[model samples]
Target: MSRPAGTKDVDYAQSMAILRTRFEWVMLIAFLIFLAVVPRIFSPETVDIINVMAIWVVGAHGLNLLTGYAGQISIGHAAFIGVGAYSTAVLILQLGLNHWWALLLAPIMTGLVGMVFGLPSLRLKGFYLAMATLAAQFILTTAFLFAMPGIVGGISGLTVPFPEIGGMSFRVPENLYYLLMPTAVLMTFFAKNIARSRLGRAFVAVRDNDLAAEIMGISLFGYKLRAFFVGCLFAGVAGWMRVCYDGCVRPDIYPLMDSIWYLGVIIIGGMGSTMGAIFGAIFVRLLHEMVLVASPALGSFFPPEIAGQLGSGLGLVVFGVVVALFLIFEPRGITHTWEILKGRIRHWPFVFAPG
Candidate 1:
């Protein structure tokens, strides 16, 4: 039987939706396959870089969820990561807990701590909220240092235990890479799904206009707190992975500067995007490492001490300038560019889809 025009339109829409969903899944599967086979193709040094990129991807995803999708700026995200790292370290060292169990609990503990700090967000906005989060960084770091010198070892850092899986230790970077990669991929998937859900819409609505969102029956207080909790959960996972990779957890490891670096990753990568988090991490980490590698070559012309200082300082300056340029010119980020390319490929032989 011939369908009516309206019914045909609905069928077309549903068919397109299915096609888009399948395409997304196919892309994701292909990416995972590539990652799984990467160790076979790359040198160990390159694989180490890939592992670091994976860790940063997790941290960037956490920051993006809070500041990008939810419009909640956090200058002290690394503090929450520290909380997770220390919690895992303490559990393994002091309590003699299994590494796997400690890793599982780390994020939950960090999320609770994040919720406590996030309470201030109910009353604060913009700069004030950012300042409040920054305060969390100082207070937590100082507390870990002077307040409990015996426990956290003051200036000296606490050693982290090697992770064990199936009675085998993961001491090598390659082994740790395999351990971290799955968690990173799962977290990225989770973030993407959440961003496509109703909760994501609520976040954007509140971000655009809190008053209007509240008027529309969204609970501003509830959603904001949930966002903080979820965001910190990702941070905790990242921290747990960091401890596994480095085999140590120090209070100084998560400094104020580290927090600033994370924020920079999200801005340069693209806010409110899962792909942005991954792209930002890879771009920033690779750029930093490239500078370090080129430092000696650039240093030959200058005195040793001066070269060292200039190389480090110039690298940071260049990083800042790149971020500034991206913010001003490509605020939507590399993800936006990727999207345009994808759209063009998908609609070949057609000018463009009507808005």
Candidate 2:
């Protein structure tokens, strides 16, 4: 005799849960292996790009937590990243601290700062909250620019020393990859864990319906603030990595446009999905690199002066167009689209009405 429908659904859910858990383990192992041999398989330049993609994955995971899970909209994530990067520079250069100590402290400081800015979430929602954070982007950048120029390095920015431990220095992408790749992996693991935890569920509840979540005894204000703190903490770590990688921290490094791109990352990947953050980071960063390569070639078609100007503008234009396309066609982001594709492939040879 056939199983009851309810029993079949329970079986399906259990099987899916098991499959997903196994898939995550497999992917983590594969990614770690990829990092291990990345320098050997790719050119140094490509390896550098891969390193950057990993760092952005860290930042995007944070944004995914805040905007994706908690339903908060922010356009100033780069500010938190800036805070982290600058904090690292300040701590190491001014306080004469080691890179390891600075690294440990930067994210905590950024998270605290993020919590302060996140306070407005108690009274604001939607566009107003976005504007408030947008204001934060300007406020923080201005502080870096004009507040303590001598200490913060002002408009000139600060140089990050090559991170060294035990008299061993890391000055190459391959070397730095050893430190950054594992950090990214660990943070990604944490994000996955958070998504499955009680607090993560609380975040989802608030995102879905604040009033209902509050009625269920969830604290909307508290959860929202915590979401911002966690998200910004991720951005801070990414910023610190970038500073270490490039050996510099500048006000312009984490600009408004970059903040928009982070939002685009989660949107393109899939809101509220950890895998979505990874997919989004890879897709967006690769697209960025391609634009950089293609821009120079396209310049040949125009006068040198005009070409220089056009090349400068090409990245933003392309990014805007791509974001618009996704918003229109795949608002649920790449994760949802991938799921649909998989479903279609599995159920091939079946047809249904276009509901």
Candidate 3:
């Protein structure tokens, strides 16, 4: 006997739901396996590249939370990251603190500093707000370079000692991967959850229209400060990671260009989406990596002097071109593109079929 129409529909819906759940689990497992094996399978240099990607992605997540979700622009986001790096270096190297303690304290310190700088947001908006952040960048950079040079190590920078975790020393890429990848995974999960929570909704409301959000009982100042704190916390953690992995903390490491690049990451990846931060970091970093590889290969075609210059500069040119293309054609970013593709796949044949 044929099943009733309602029963068939219900069975089909249930099957689809089960399939979706299974697919999600399978994807998560596959990704975890990849993270585990990638360092072992890849060369040491490739492992380094992956490590850099994770570090920057963590930093970009912070910017996305501020600019993408909270509609607050920070041209000096890298300064906060510098704070974290310097803080970690001082805490671990100078103060004789444990790596674990430095890791915990860096973000907290950075968050407090961010909140202080973020006070300007209460009075500024748009270009004015950007200028305030730009000032912050200059001021913090000066501090890093000149203010109490003995403390920040001035321009020479501070050496970062190897981190000891449990009984294992993280002196090599294979071991360090455990420290970084897990932190990245945890922070990304935290960002994702924040985006779906009540505060995340308030952030969206403020971004969409602050005045309306105010009328709806959302405190602009409070949310804005919280966003900055959270964002800087992420930057601080990433900065701490840099010190741990690179074995040094330099003032120039977090430059004005870096702050801009972080913003570009979110723009290219898609604003207001956690995955967009990750996508943007991977996309931009991969482009930089490819340029590094190809530039030397193309050097043979030119004079040694010219080849050297091209090798050094071509990456920036390519990065600029890619950013321009994304702005012109896909302003909503890669996340939006993914969503469209996903919707099409779900709807399938009828999506493109003629009437």
Candidate 4:
């Protein structure tokens, strides 16, 4: 890790510590406090946006661990999220269970489902592995759409009650923000810790070279499955969050395009890092909002006949252009760029160049 001048690690403990200085600890605490109070500061619409960002953070983290860290390719992550959303709904509605219990079990159910699809990782890889997971997306979504109408609710989907306990409900935007943002923060902590642990190192090894990892006695089967399970587990948690936020669980909610966008999130945010997942989610969500706003506004500049076409088509064009620009110029993603800026700032005056 890069540090400011005079910063030195004298021991392994110091080197490994996330908050090495008083400033670091202070910043972390301040950030937490800010998150806690953000709903009070932002508009209700913006707060709702933040809630959605939280869901993306959780979903992106799952994909980061699997595709970015473990090198397992999946294009159907949203389907797993659907599994979680539907599972939670089923557990709560069909079984007469509490939403709390559903929350606990739904993610586990999704993880198990992910592991089943992950079986192909033992033999197939790359495009083949992606194809396998894509199949999972279609199969699971098909089931969600047509499985047991009485249980899964089929096309109309299931209606989930708002999260409530002890007479307090999180149905409103501000209250839901409190419920969601903290969960995203907790998941961030979990993902960061996982990235630095022994398991995380093993994941990196497998991602870099699976055969080499196996030669080094790393269990390819175990690690790959664990990656899929854990990643999909995050997706499940995100699904739960989304269902709770929307008050419904429908097949249309978790689309294949969403899974692709999650992949794009990690790619544009920088893969293989927890912060990358976060940065990517914020960037993508903000970009989405900006495009939505800008598309209609740009139509005003065009003639009436062309305005309608421009309004409908500009968003896709802008999205493609932005993604292309990032891929061409900043393939490492925003997190890597952030690190470089920090490095330059820290080394300014003596080692930094003017340009």
Which candidate achieves the best lDDT against the true structure? 4
Q: Write the per-residue lDDT of candidate 3 for residues 1-355, one digit (tens) a residue.
A: 1222223324655554422355568988899999999877999888888888989889999999988999989999899999899999999877989888998999999988888888999999878989999998988888888987787799999888889866788878878888888999889988887887888898888889999999999999899999889999998999898888888988888899889889889999999999899999998889888998899999989999899999988987887888899999999899999877865664565464232
- Clashing residue pairs for model 3: none
TM-score of each: 0.91, 0.90, 0.91, 0.96
Worst lDDT 10-window in candidate 4: 346-355
Runs off by more than 4 Å, candidate 3: 1-20, 352-355
RMSD (Cα, Å) for all candidates, in order, is 4.0, 3.8, 4.6, 2.1
lDDT digits (tens) for residues 1-355 of candidate 2: 1221233324655544523444557986796797788889888898889889988999999999999999888888998899999999999999999788887899889988898889988889999999999998999898888878889999999988989868767788878887788888889988988887798999999999999999999998789989988988898888788887889988888899889999999989999999899999999999999999999999999889999988889989999999899999999899998877755644454432122
Please give, for residues 172-238, the per-residue lDDT of candidate 4 as tens digits.
9999998889889989899999999998999999999888999999999999999999999998889
Prediction 2 global C-alpha lDDT = 0.86
Please, what is the whole-model Cα lDDT of each candidate in the order they appear?
0.84, 0.86, 0.86, 0.90
* lDDT (10s digit) by residue, model 1, range 1-355: 1222223324655544423355567986897899898878888888888888888899999889888988888998888898888888888888888778886898888888888888998899899999999999998887767766666667786887788878778887677778889889989988887887888888888778999999999999998888888889899999898899889877788899889989989888899988899999998998889888888788998999899897878778878898999989999887888777766665554546423
Output the TM-score of candidate 2: 0.90
- Model 3 TM-score is 0.91
- Candidate 3: C-alpha RMSD after superposition: 4.6
lDDT of 2 at 175: 82
Q: What is the lDDT of candidate 4?
A: 0.90
